[model samples]
Target: MVARVGLLLRALPLLLWGRLDAQPAERGGQELRKEAEAFLEKYGYLNEQVPKAPTSTRFSDAIRAFQWASHLPVSGVLDRATLRQMTRPRCGVTDTNSYAAWAERISDLFARHRNKMRRKKRFAKQGNKWYKQHLSYRLVNWPERLPEPAVRGAVRAAFQLWSNVSALEFWEAPATGPADIRLTFFQGDHNDGLGNAFDGPGGALAHAFLPRRGEAHFDKDERWSLSRRRGRNLFVVLAHEIGHTLGLTHSPAPRALMAPYYKRLGRDALLSWDDVLAVQSLYGKPLGGSVAVQLPGKLFTDFEAWDSHSPQGRRPETQGPKYCHSSFDAITVGSHFWEVAADGNVSEPRPLQERWVGLPPNIEAAAVSLEDGDFYFFKGGRCWRFRGPKAVWGLPQLCRAGGLPRHPDAALFFSPLRRLILFKGARYYVLARGGLQVEPYYPRSLQDWGGIPEEVSGALPRPDGSIIFFRDDRYWRLDQAKLGATTSGRWATELPWMGCWHANSGSALF
Candidate 1:
């Protein structure tokens, strides 16, 4: 029965082809050869690179691979439909280090071979014809006119942001032509059937797509404002959406454009050096420099990636610091194992044990005091101190730090130079020998860079004596000298969102 079924399937193609009158075989063969040669020349491949005759074994294998690549059925025979595809021009740039490049090459090669088989049989249909081209998209239902020049200028500025990237090429076609990119604006009432609508507050202000043929859609329904009017900034939100379109997801740097919040920007405010550097690393280089820093892991397992939406499963685990007293090597929390440095080389990473203690649940923040060798973990709106190796000592509650109104995702940095401990969350605090107190440090422009209304996930002291803070997807640096002299300190440029907590140096070997 299986043999009979296979025979019938094989004969089905012949039955269909039998209906078409055979034109002079010579005429059909000549046309096929000419078209195939043209495609090879246009795509910069030698004629010999693609098999000319259907019966050739090399031709059969090439066509099979091409068919498989394009997601078509793998039939080794080179039909007329496939032949036309073999003739079309191919435009693909190759990069050895790029994962995207490798994926695209595999797709292109498969499409080319599949086209050869289709063209041989003259089965190429209009929509089905293999066009060795990237996917194209275009904007639809764009506004005919803007309410004000400010809005128009802002839109142009957003487009220019991605266009200026050295690694990205923005192509604009005639108004009626197809485009590889599309931009659209929808009123708050418009819904994409996916429940993604811009309600009055906290709904999506805008969303962007990935590189190939992606569209950026903004919800025009919300009342757009310039600055932090009523605590919302349209320019800030638009800038962030633009960053998404440029292939940057949300980062933990608070001041970064990719931060997941609405921010306001002035007309003069453009991409900072850090912003340019980050985007350039992904797209290529501006004037040309090294690529952005690559972390060891494919995904960050820090606190930020924790999904509150997940039903209580096993909590993600982390190991405590391991010490090498003999080598004077100490591994701090949040440090990953990296290559060995010359004199300060820190060897392999020792994993921490995961176990439950009779302590409070929902611990949101933690800090280690190197001076006293005590680790403090915060949960339930209070701080608890634990001592001994691996924090296995009896835990005792410390004086409650009362500034935080809510449980905060926090970071603690011990500044050895200033002999002070800095606790950062929605706001920055200093813990000295006396007690915990809110530092008088604020951004120069109190209205623009005042208290953080959200929890901070990370903090570190820079070599330059400035404090660096990391929030959702942005990073900000506070200069100590500037903070002392004026209300606001110098803000270092934003860094990429690496994880909830990051460190410049320090590691431990097992």
Candidate 2:
């Protein structure tokens, strides 16, 4: 069915990096016309304009169309209100698809009273959409502020925000694996197109490819955050991008999550009625008996205060690695684990292969059971349980058998949950500490923890009962009370036990 173009309706402001195309504060008639022409052309309101009389006529008509869709006076003149509206932050996607989608959608809303099934049928034929119900996505890389686990949780929850309301299911593909969709972070021009290049920080925060292409790009320069109103909210932006991947256009509804401009996560549901109806039109109602999942705005608002937390404040012991001035040439190539005592004394480096007979070298992640006091070591796909350098019998089992990831990013005996938690990408696994078995509802999305990132080296359970995750030269300290990262910095300097502190410095630099 060729859907009829319905009446023009209101569409909220959409994404455009106002930074890349800034205008002087003062504007003359020519300036106003120039801005209007660019806005109309960029958003699909008008065709290319020239000095011809016909072009002027179309330009005036384009002004009226934009004014009408924006719910302003449709006098066909570039009035003050219309000029002000052009400056609003919006989605970078062309408005051409959105208006057409909304036109069909409005007609469907009207037709639903007489025929509901036909509404779905006609709208289904509109344009491009993924044929498969179950889709997979991979995050090629992410921002530095939040770790991979936390970022995964946010993205997973955003995807769930849609799948809950539609007949869709999404799973994150493994790194180095094929995926239907791939989300990545890039700064400046990483070569999608010059027009689509991210304009650092405030402007053109991110953009996504329409369906089947299945790609979304975020500006690494932007301060992308989850749960908080500060910085560009990554959760909100990714939700909007996820909508586009599911063949959704920018929404015309004021409250829609697909609106091009940034909005803080509110206390109510993330997906507006318009947003839900748009996706459902293409995918139909969710299959099976599950009810729709509407995440509360307060749920995001409560993802920890991202507290002004300081580390547990311990000074380096007098005896701990007194090589503050050691030359870089002293560093070895092989990985080594050294036990740092409570008084900050560093033990002699011990190789994993030497400490445990069966456990191989280069342990990926390790966690000591707070309950059993059994040291757990993970290498590649095999796991080893040890007690005082003695390997337990029948212990070098496959991680897959116990429901743990082959090589997890980090592992810790989470003090708050009191379970052995393992982090990989966007999902985390909980193991029965004693048996080392993945719990019943284990290997769940990391969205609950909300902001841990990928490729972290190790996790340390601190004496004060907090968890500190190590990645490169940095470490993120997870607040046990709130279950979120409160403080993060270089582990060598922030943590005195790591033994990289300057001997003469008595206080933290920050």
Candidate 3:
């Protein structure tokens, strides 16, 4: 009966791109569009002249570029996240510098530093390196673009990355007091006692003094955004600068966050192998043990036993690939699905229609039930059920009729819990097994899973009974047992299991 009703609801039109009834989302007005264009122009995202009144494809494309760089969903319209990012104050580091130029400069700087070290005879042949294991930092002047709370969170998260891998313990200090590390945002010419000053916007983004001195500065002229994928990713820049604060130097490795050139990292922010080795060379491994390596392929296979390693070489395009595990791992991207054999070889991406006759094109999300061997497909607000290769009766059902949210951003069935986890916005709903009969108390905030970000695109269950939620290019791992406890996470590309060769490529999203 419920399935019949759900089928009726599924027949209704879907609300895509904000609302079904509303026209395509456009710039709020001429003034707002101009502001958006100007913001991108300042950061070099917009090349052409700012449109006096922007409704053009050029303007929208520029906006999309910024959104893509920042790791926001690629919607060209001036969304709130985009606007918020445009206004955040940030370091004026230019992203236009060539990687070759940066590599050359950084190489020269390292040579000079090596010469200086030899002169002072400060190089120790081998031993525990960091002068102190515990480090403290304080923010003296907050930037106006982002709120103080946001800045604090960004800074804390950046520091947490280093702490996660090394024995270093970081604590927040009062804004006004003397601290081992002092942080501030400034315009051009703010002195940091190092005799160097900022060149305003379009030059260096931010810089940090070496360890023991512990001073970091941000150029106040640039707009900053705290959203992981909107403005400038403060977390990305700060993570790199903080490496310097910990006494690590620039890495010539392109994937290293400490590379001299500041590149838009897209959805990636985790430290690279070069970064991990350098920091451990300085501070030694974490007291608990060496940092656990995170690779997309690691959880499912025995590829490596150490941190800072991933499967190298080219991999198939996996952006928005729907992953499901029946007896073996299966993933779909667009209209194609690939079965990952037990031996770890992925079958060719075959069309879904070739295998499952009634399945719709471009499925947004999918989950396989362990109890029933059934596959659930979600697109917009509707869902379909399949057993083996055939569609179940009452075909495309409305998610809402089953008590699930309309247009879930992501969903997966938790076989152990006999519940379906539906994700939308900042919250997730838990429903009973077969259909979306709502759990007694659901729609819990994503806060339940510490370190998980909002707007998750999909999720995959790990062999160890844990689940990893993905957003943009990164992912967070949470043990099903400790739902409320903080779980470990890293960039999917950084882990060997995923076999991603570049920052933008990974199989975790969609």
Top candidate, metric TM-score: 2
- How many collisions per candidate? 35, 17, 18
Those runs of model 1 whose alpha carbons end farther than 4 Å from true positions after fitting are 1-149, 163-165, 169-173, 188-191, 226-232, 266-277, 287-510
lDDT-sorted candidate list, best first: 2, 3, 1
TM-score of model number 3: 0.39
Query: What are the per-residue Cα lDDT tens digits for candidate 2 across 1-510?
Result: 223322222121222234223433245768778878877887777853344548779888888777766767788777666777787655667665455556666776787642353333212234578888999999888998765666776777778888999999999898888999888999899897777777776657778777778988888888776645356778788888878787776766666788666555543468888887777777877899667767545345322221112233222344234222111101111234566666555677666557567764445677788776888877567777888788875658777777678766677788666888788867888887564588888778766664556656578888787877765446788877877888888665667776565556644322
The estimated TM-scores of all candidates read 0.29, 0.52, 0.39
Ten-residue region with minimum lDDT total, candidate 1: 321-330
lDDT of 3 at 224: 64
Instruction: List lDDT for all candidates, in order.
Output: 0.41, 0.67, 0.60
* Better candidate number, 1 or 3, judged by TM-score: 3
lDDT of candidate 3 over 58-153, digit per residue (tens):
778777766655556788877767776666533343232223223444455568752222211111123313478887788787768665655666
Sequence-dependent TM-score of model 1 = 0.29
